[model samples]
Target: MYALVDCNNFYASCERLFRPDLQGRPIVVLSNNDGCVVARSAEAKRLGIKMAVPLFQVQEQIDRENIAVFSSNYALYGDISARVMTVLEQQAPAIEVYSIDEAFLDLNGLETNFPLVEYGLQLKQRVYQYTGIHVSVGIAPTKTLAKLANHAAKQYPATRGVVDLSDPLRQRRLLGLLPVQEVWGVGRRLSRRLNQQGVSSALALADCDAAWIRSHYSVTLERTVRELNGQPCMALEECPPPRQQILCSRSFARRITEYRDMRSAIAQYCSRAAEKLRQQGGLARVVTVFIRTNPHSQLETFYSHSASRMLSIPSADSRLLSATAHALLQSIWKPGFRYMKAGIMLSDLYPSGSFQPTLFDAPESPAAMRLMQAVDNINRSGRGQVRFASEMLSSGWQMQRNRLSPAYTTRWDQLPVVRA
Candidate 1:
């Protein structure tokens, strides 16, 4: 059996973890730069606050309905996720960290001995005890069914945050009731296509011929069908490989007009991206920088642009890539436009140590490696931030409009104090 364990309204739950006073209240978490609603609590959802609704558009609703809003506190969320995963790892034989707030646990051998449903309740209780975040666990013979079961667990309070769809008849009946688009890997386009073909339910899609699906729809659809039919095509991966591309981009809380400010923002993003690349043992050959104006602004002269600069040599080094990124920004940035968002993307990645050394640009030296280690260690220990140029601080190139909660689990200073 495969079990999918997902946190209940993760960001909102994280906010609730420390501030138990906000229990059962309407709450929503904003995206980067407090732009839009990225996460909503059940109470907030009950008020019909749609996900991704612009913060400005919902400001009236918030004020009128007395909705609580919070900034995305990733530090707290990550720490809570770590605690949840750690507790789950101890309980399950093997656990796959699927996302920030989701995981898959293999429950193959416990059907006869320990009941899966009871195990799920225990999982939930343990997770809550460890981190004060409620989670729902769904069990099925296949990953796709497990995902659907998880959704059911989240919606149906009767399940008590645990649902198992391992029975064949139950799986079929459940799929028949669910919309085709709700199936795993089915997006809007594919859902529309399936609807056109008169396949309006997940069961209907699963009943489609695999050959026809492979021909018309994608191989992905076929895989989904197989998974729905209790074939686990995708195996659980314990530690997935690092991402091929690293991006750090955000809309500014306010528009930026000056060239120096834009340059500084781009530099900070590049530096952050480079640090991530190096941490993952990857190097990027292409550096992309982009700046744009807000689309919703009344100002008519709207403009947005991006430029990619090919690196002289693939590098994970912050100093080298950041310099190249600054040069790219110079080409793409246009004066007089009030830019709202700027970002950096490092792509065409390769393993840091496996890069072919070029005659023109040599690889990093031993001394450079040691310096990087020292920088990473100091930053990890919180003595200082990963800094290169003083312009980063001077230009206010940091997370914007952040009204974040304390890092209750991650930071020592921010941890909750227990009364003696």
Candidate 2:
């Protein structure tokens, strides 16, 4: 059997973990720069606050309902996700971290006289007790079927946030009710196409001939069809794949026309991207920089451009990447336009120590490597003091996070308070 464990309202739950006062409030976490609604609590959903709705569009309801708003804090959310994944790693013999908010657990080998449903409940309780984050568990025979079970768990209150599809009758009934689009790997376009072909529900698609489906679509959809029929084609990946590309980007709180600010933003982006690269132990040969004026703003001239540069040799050194990104930014940057966002992209990544060095290009110095490693370590400890000279002293382009809670877990000063 397989189990899909997913955190419920992950971003909002993370926010609420710190602020208990927001337990029953209409909480909505915004996207980069507090621009749009990304995650909303169940209460917020009742208010018809759709995901990706701009804050300005919902400001009236936000003020009227006293909605608790927050800007996206990737740092805090990332830390919380790590904590949750740690708990899962401790419990599950094998786990595939499907996303920051979800994972797949292999439950085949465990000898439990207790019911699997009871075991799933226990796993859920342990995660909640340890991290104070609520998660739903769905157990099934296949990965795709496990996803449907998870969906049912979320949709029906009777499931109590846990569903088991080991029963054939339950599996059949659930598949009959589930729309094709709701099935894993079936998007809107594919669902519409399937609907045209009389494949309306998951049951219908599962009943379709696998060879016929393979002829029409690809092997992946065929596999999904089989998986929906209680066959497990996709195996749980115990280790997630290394990211093929690293991108660091964010929208500024306010539009700026200054080239210096753009330079600073690009450098910061490159620095952060380099940090991720080193964490993954990968080196990049291609660096791309891009900037754009807000297309949604009628007052600003719409301009967007991107420039890419190939490094003479692949490197993960922050200073070198920052310099390359800055030069690329300068080439694409234009004056008299209000720039809303800028980003850095590193691609063609190779393993850090095994990559071939270019003939004419110099490899990173031993001292530079040691310095960056130490810098990463210091920053990991919550002291973000090590930064490039070209980088701004403060994030002038920082997102608007007026309602953000403190870094309760990561920062010493922001640790939770408890009464004895």
Candidate 3:
């Protein structure tokens, strides 16, 4: 058996963790730059505020309903997620972290004779007790079914936030009720195609022959079909594979017209991407920088361009990456375009110390590696404490987080105070 544990309204829950006054109130967490609604509390969902709706579209409703609004506080949310994952790590024999707000726990030996539902309930209670965040638990014979069980647990209040679909009959019954889109791997486009083909429900898709599904759709979809039939096609990955490329990009709060601002943004992005590459013990051989104007703006001309430079040797040193990124930005940047977004991509990656150097190639310096390690250690202790000089301290292109909450758990000064 496998169990999927998912945090309920994760971003909103994190916001309410330190603010008890916000409990039972409608809350919505905005995306980067406070552009649109990314997460909504259950209360907010009940008010018919759709996901991804622009803030301006619901401004009147927000004011009239007195809804609590917040900009994304990733630091607090990441810290809380770590706490929740820590609790699961201690309890489960083996685990797969699916996302920031979800994980899959292996229960093969643990649930031999013990009641799965009871075990799930215990997990749910422990997570809430330790982290003060509510989670729904779904237990099943396969990961896909476990995901479906979790969906049912969240959609129905009577499940008490725990559902077990280990029984084949129960799995079929629930599958019949759920739309094909609700299946783990089936996305909107696939679901639409399935609906057109009369495979509108999970049960219908599962009933189709796996070979036919593979021939009609893909091998991946076939695996999903097999999983829905209680056959586990995918195994839990304790350690996910390393990324082949590291991309650091963001949409700006406003259009950037000056070359210096664009250079600052790209430099910061390169520093971030290089940090990630080093964290994974990898070095990048190619650096790419891209800048683009807003595609939706009617007044501004749409412009987008990107350029890549091959490094002399694969390196994870942020200084080298930032310098290359800046040169790439200079090569592609247009003077008059009001650039709205820029990013850095590090590709052609190889494991650190694994690349063979040719006679003509200069090897990466050990001193440079040590310096980067020191910088990473300091930044990890406290972000932005040891940024490079090229990265701007303050810039107009920075994301607008006017409604951001304090870092309740990660920062010493931002911790909540209890008043009697």
Candidate 4:
């Protein structure tokens, strides 16, 4: 058996975790630079504030409805996610972290007569008690069905955020009611094509001949068909594969016109990308930088360019990556255009110490590695605690987060106080 546990309105719930007074209020969390809605509470959904809609487009509605808006507080969200995962780790025999707000648990080896739904309810309650984040749990014989059950738990309040699809009859009934897109692997486009083929619901897809699906569509979709029939086609990935490339990019709060500001932004992005590379114990052979004017801005001339440089030897050192990225930025930087966004990409990644270095190639020094490790350690304790001199200390190109909440869990100064 497998179980999927997913947080409810994760970002908004994280915001409400500390703000009890804001419970039941319409809330929404914005993307980077307060650009668009990324997460919304149930009340906000009820108000018809669609996801990913520009904040400016809904500003009047928000003001009229007394909606609570927040900039993405990633530090707080990450900390809370860690706490929730900790609770799950203690409860489950083995688990796979599917995302920041979702995980899959292995429920095999339990007593056959064990109450799965009751166990799921207890697990949900434990996570809420420990992390103050409500979660929905779905248990089933297959991972795909588990995901479907989790969706059902979220959609129907009568389930009380717990759904078990162990029975074939119950799975069939729910699958009949759900659209084909609600199936685990079927997406919007695929669902549309399936709908045209008379497979409009999960039950219909499950009823399709697996051999015919594989011949007509893809082997992957065939697996989805089998999984929908309560056969396990996908196994839990306890350890996710390492990424081949790391990218750090963001749109600026305002347009940048100066060369120095662009340099600072690229350096900062490269530093972040290097940190991720080191975290994954990987080294990059190529560093690329890109800058662009707002494509949506009619007043400014559109300009976008990127340049990449191959390193003599693969390395994850922040100084080396930042220097390479800055050089790439210099090569691509245009003078007149007002740049709205910039980013750094590190590619051709290899596991650290795995690549062979020639005599002419200059490998990263032990001293440099130690310094970077120290810097990462400090930053991990609290982000931006230590940064490269090239990274701007304070700059106008920084993201606009006017409505950001305090880092309640990560920062000592921002920690909530009890008056009692």
Query: TM per model?
Result: 0.93, 0.95, 0.98, 0.97
Error of 2 at 257 (Å): 0.7
Error of 1 at 328 (Å): 1.9
Candidate order by decreasing lDDT: 3, 4, 2, 1
Q: How does model 3 fare in lDDT? A: 0.93
The collision pairs in model 2 are none
lDDT of 4 by residue, 1-420 (tens): 999999999999999999999989999999999999999999999999999999999999999999999999998999999999999989878899999999999999663757998899899989988888999999999999999999999999999999999999999999999999988878899999999999999999999999999999999999998998889999988888999899999999989999988888888888889999999999999988889999997787899999999998999999888888877887898898899889989999999888999988877788988999999998887655887788874488999999999999998889999897
Q: Against the true structure, whose TM-score is highest? A: 3
lDDT per residue, candidate 1, 185-240, as tens digits? 99999899889999999999889888899999788889899999888888888878
Ranking by TM-score: 3, 4, 2, 1
How big is the positional error of residue 40 in model 1, measured in Å on the Cα after superposition?
A: 1.4
| Predictions in order: lDDT | 0.86, 0.88, 0.93, 0.92
Worst window of 10 by summed lDDT in candidate 3: 382-391
Regions of candidate 2 where Cα sits further than 4 Å from its true position? 296-300, 358-362, 418-420
Total clashes in model 2, counting residue pairs 3 or more apart in sequence or in different chains:
0
Number of residue pairs clashing in candidate 4, backbone atoms closer than 3 angstroms, sequence gap of 3 or more or interchain: 0
Report the Cα lDDT for residue 270, model 3: 88
